[model samples]
Target: MADKEATVYVVDLGASMGDCHNGRDESDLDFGMRYVWDKISTTVAASRKTWTLGFVGLNTDETNNTQDEEGLEGYHNISTLQEIGPMTMTELRELHPKVKPCEAYSGDALSAIVVAITMIEEFTKKLKFKRRIILVTNGESPIDDEDDSITDVAEKLNEHNIELVIIGVDFDDPEYGFKEEDKSRAKRQNEETLRKLVEACENGVFGTMQQAVEELSIPRIKPVRPFKAYDGPLTLGDPNKYESAISINVERYFKTKRATPPSATTVVVNPDRGYTQSQAFDDGDVEMGGTEFSNVKHMRKYKVNDPSAPGGKLDVPYEELAKGYLYGRTVVPFSDSDMAITKYETTKSFTIIGFIPFDSYSPFLNMGETGLIAAKKFDEKSEIGLSALIHALHELESYAVARYVQKDGAQVQILLLKPNPGIEDEYECLYDVPLPFAEDVRSYQFPPLDKVLTVSGNVLKEHRLLPNQDLKEAMSDFVDAMDLSGFDVDEDGNPVDYAPIDEVYNPVIHRLNQAIRTRAVHPDGEIGPPPEILLRFSKPPEKLIKKARPDIEALIDAAELKKVPEKAKGRFKEAVKPLSGLDIDAILGQKKRTVISPENAIPEFKQALATAEDDETVEKAVKQMGEIIRKLITNSFADVFYPRAAENLRVLREELIGLDLPLLYNKFLRALKKSLLSGELNGDRREMWFKYIIGGQLGLVTKEESEMSDVTEEDAKAFVKK
Candidate 1:
């Protein structure tokens, strides 16, 4: 379990706390205490081993009456109910009745801070615990004396490394019902003082009632250390040879290094010194000018600060360091002499001494006792190694030869075997025999080709019937019958055939001549000559055709027979239709007028209502008026329509009362209820609808308002029934 933290909640029980806010029935002090206690209980339940809570109420009845007490001389109106201790469900339940606003005066903010600090100091004496003081108030603290200020308390809290949180319940909240004139100047001053006090502490938070409560409900989860597992294979014996070896699992830790060289270059100059002359016994001539000066370049090694050694640094080599891998927590340094060869620092977490073969490897990969695979608790390395081996074998489509080590200290091993591509499955392994070449191998016998050959009599008959003369004659006749002369080619060289007119005329003319001959000998007696025959010759057979066909002549003169009669003459003339019996004068008058604004809509709505003959018509007009008003409100004319709606509702109510039509009144109320219940209005629109339409205009009681009013349950039942 982690170390426990001590939290002291400093609740304000001043006179102002007796006032209710936030649409609740209880006073602010009552609601705030309940909310705070609920959060504390939740936190304690979630982190039973990590949290201890305490309670302190300011401006209690006992503290308000007593001006001074030992060790608390200057701090008045402060009551310490519980010292910081492990919280329990019973203790939390007992706090509800104890925290109340029964005091006559406002709480002293500085005094409350002093009491909380003193309590926390004593509570954290034996055991060092994180301390926090939560002060919940309405920012209406009593004025401090000249000698002491809230800053003094904040300094003391900071010195002790305690956190201070101020939960401010704004008295000027609209729900509190405080007017502009009712806001005291001292309230602003008190708020500023509280803000300064919070700023004074290193870890202090000032928030509203809601923010404070919400923050406490969130669960604080401790972070876990991160780690990674090994993914490749590790074996004890040579991997390529089919030698018995033990499979093992291992984990790896990565180490990285950067090569940083010296920032500046240095050069060393060696000047040749002139030789000195010897004394009188000088055996050889002294050389004055010897060798020239040579410049040698040198580089300083870059050093990094060593955190383990105070005021110490270590030099780094110019070459890049090799990456190191560790199996466990142990770190092994890379060998500089053998830098070309890579090596892993591994710890034997598990050893596989046996092997079990199954038809499928999937069961071994599963996680339970029924699974075929098993491993040691510290076998992460071996697990990864075995998985890699199995994956490789599966990829290569091969199997392994399991061989257990027979030696006393030897580990087991499995050698993977792949089939030889050159060997056939049917052939046995042979050492001395060599196979013959493909061209030198023995061959099989073949049958004679002449003995297998034969011919059918039908083949000879089909040869004699080739290219029949009858088909050739028929195709020739078809080609001659088709008239290709009329066919022509277009600009694009594609054939365009105009249909032969002679083919169309011959068929129709033959049918017409047959019909004329047949009709000349009609059953009723010969009808002279057929008209088609006379008309085809271009002869004036109109007189003969007209005499022969009276029906045709009537059809030709039918247009003259169907002329409409002249408009009705004399006194029986029709009057103009009255335009579907509608009052054109009224419609025209309305069309001539323009609706310039929302205010103009109001008069028109009023006229509609006045002219309505029945309740149904009046209801329709009211609905239309409401639509107009709603549009005006959406268009930023709410200020105009709001008051207008109120006045109109008042007038309508009075008119309803004068008429004494209870049914109409009930219907109107039902419509208003439906409008409020429907989800048409959202957010601010809903609030506006409730404030103006339901409460102000219709005077309907909402569920919340009803609970606070004199209306009884029976009255509600009767209203709903109606």
Candidate 2:
């Protein structure tokens, strides 16, 4: 379970704060709200019920706090827009328009803090919670500190263990190096009073708003509570069968996992629904509110082609469709009765299959999420047994291979368990990671790097493909100089490991979360560039690169390395060149296109084919057409380019038919089928094959359609079956 947190943000929305300050483009109210919104939106994104937030607007048009109801003098024009409770996008949206600056600027900043303190104390009475009060203001409003009793509020904050943070706009901060020139006398008095209030508290922070906003760019790593994935006895053998068999109760918890960005929900605009009139501006982007949105609905219907039906497609009941399993390019129907025959039923179990020396296992075999298998806590017997096994394995320097079934009928998983010993009397554990099966592991053979083999099968050690002694030595020196193992120094003046595993955060995960939180409040605002910390390891240390300069120069000289320009891509680059480096097309008096643009690809292809004088020219034209089709499929945003590609194939079919070159069309269609189904063209474009090719009658040409074609009608039909 996570700890309880109660935070109240008191924002000063005084009339004076409505104007721009510190030579900034935006109003003072908006500047301070940036820091507030960031913190509040983070809490909302967490969506934890224990994490509660409250908002108090100072110098608002209305007075609606507990103190005001009690006829308090200094609490005028201050309103509690939000009560201390669980916050969500709905709550965040509701609070947005209510926090705007009002014309009246009579509210006291000290009174707002006291109200926030009172709210936290009353709501969290007799409850253990991390209480915090954040005050964001421009320090423009007057403070009635003499009558408000700053000492009393400070003591109340300390008594409840509430941390108070006071951030001011352009207020003098030596550490932050920020000060507003020619500050007003009233603003100085207010800043001094707030500083004294923060000083009186045990847990308090006082800083300029600019300093707080700067720290917002630093991504905060969220700590997650580990949940037990598996809780059962880890057995070496069946304990019931033999008394010698060992069984230890243990719990499996995730140690490390790949964090993924939050997926977006599908939505549609529905004007009928009620909306909120809210517009938060930043950099001229006004998030035009009142645009109602609703979840998009999916309506799926199954049908088969039927000429008898009005639409030529018969609507079939979804329940009538049966699941199928693919068997060698065939979909074998799998009925409910036959399902049990194929399922490899398994019961929940975790047992060691065998043990191997730790050195025998390779890290490359690790497949997915790493986990910890710790003995169940508060069980001395299980802990002792687990400790004994761990110590024995550690001394032997061995790891255990275990078969695990999470639940009944679940698929089995192979796990590699390494022992981790704890201090005396502490619980011992084993680190575990999933291991790939023999079938899951793929092996590919590559050509030898040390030597090259000629066409006559003679090995050559002095080939250019293999690095020579001087080149290899220079490369080794460069690699050694660029090492980052001890490049970073610790705070204590000791050499610490650079870019440690724990310190290197996943940039994609943090960057996405940061954007989501920022956009949640700003909506249409710009999310600034990636944080400096996230980009820290983007490049190697400059000092090391400088140190490796000599080695790099030596390697380049020894290897004779030169910058190679990017060669022309696609089939068009296959233009023939003679030994004299003369373009063959130019010599032959033919205009050869180096590339084809998408806009006029078909026209250029037709023109090339029309001017083709020989088989080589014709083949080149066909290859260019193929390249255009492949690019259209690969670079498509959705299926936008699919229609264009289909049109090109249709035109090519007619051209091939007119020229009686059925083989060319048949060969390209076969290759297209292979690439499409094999996911080489980006995704499973089977729909394109069915809708555009097969359904559009763009399949292999048969003798019925062209007498020059040798394709049988049955074979041509079967070729496009799937």
- TM-scores, all models, native as reference: 0.33, 0.76
lDDT of 2 by residue, 1-722 (tens): 68999999999888988898667899999989888898898898888999998999999888899998998788898899999999867667768878787997888888898899899989999799999999998887788766358888888889999999998888899877887889999989888988999899999999998888888877787888897889999999899899999999989999987778788876566665455543332322222245555566679999899999988999999888888989999999988778888889899999999999977988988999999998898988898999899999999999999999988888899999988886654646899999998899889999998999899999999987789899889989988888887677889978888987766877888899988887888777798888888898899878888888898899899989766555443223333345567876677896755455668988788767655557787777788888889898888777888899999999989888866787888999999999988989998787788888888899999998788788998998778774
List where candidate 2 sits over 4 angstroms from the true fold. Answer: 145-148, 171-189, 276-290, 304-315, 326-331, 423-427, 455-457, 486-495, 541-550, 565-722
After TM-score superposition, the amount by which residue 182's alpha carbon in candidate 2 deviates from its true location, in angstroms, is 5.3
Q: Which ten residues in a row have the lowest lDDT in candidate 1?
A: 427-436
Model 1 stretches astray by more than 4 angstroms: 22-25, 47-50, 64-68, 145-148, 171-182, 213-722
Mind giving the per-residue lDDT tens digits that candidate 1 earns over 1-722?
46568888888888888897656687777657645755574454444656887888887776631235564465666777776777654454456567777654655777777777877787687577888989888766575743357667778988888999887775332443433335567877776677778787899987667554444333222333323222223354545574676554433221112222213223233334343332111322222112122334457776779876556876777675544658598767676767645433333232232333435333223221110122223667665555565555445655443332323344332222222222354311101111223453567887432233225523232232342344445445444434344344678877665333322223234334334323322223343333342234344235434443544333435322344445433212332235366866577775322232455655665455444456666666556555554454444333554566555555554444433333344455556545545634321344445666556645533333323234455654565545
Provide the global lDDT of candidate 2 against the true structure. Answer: 0.85
RMSD of each candidate?
46.7, 11.0
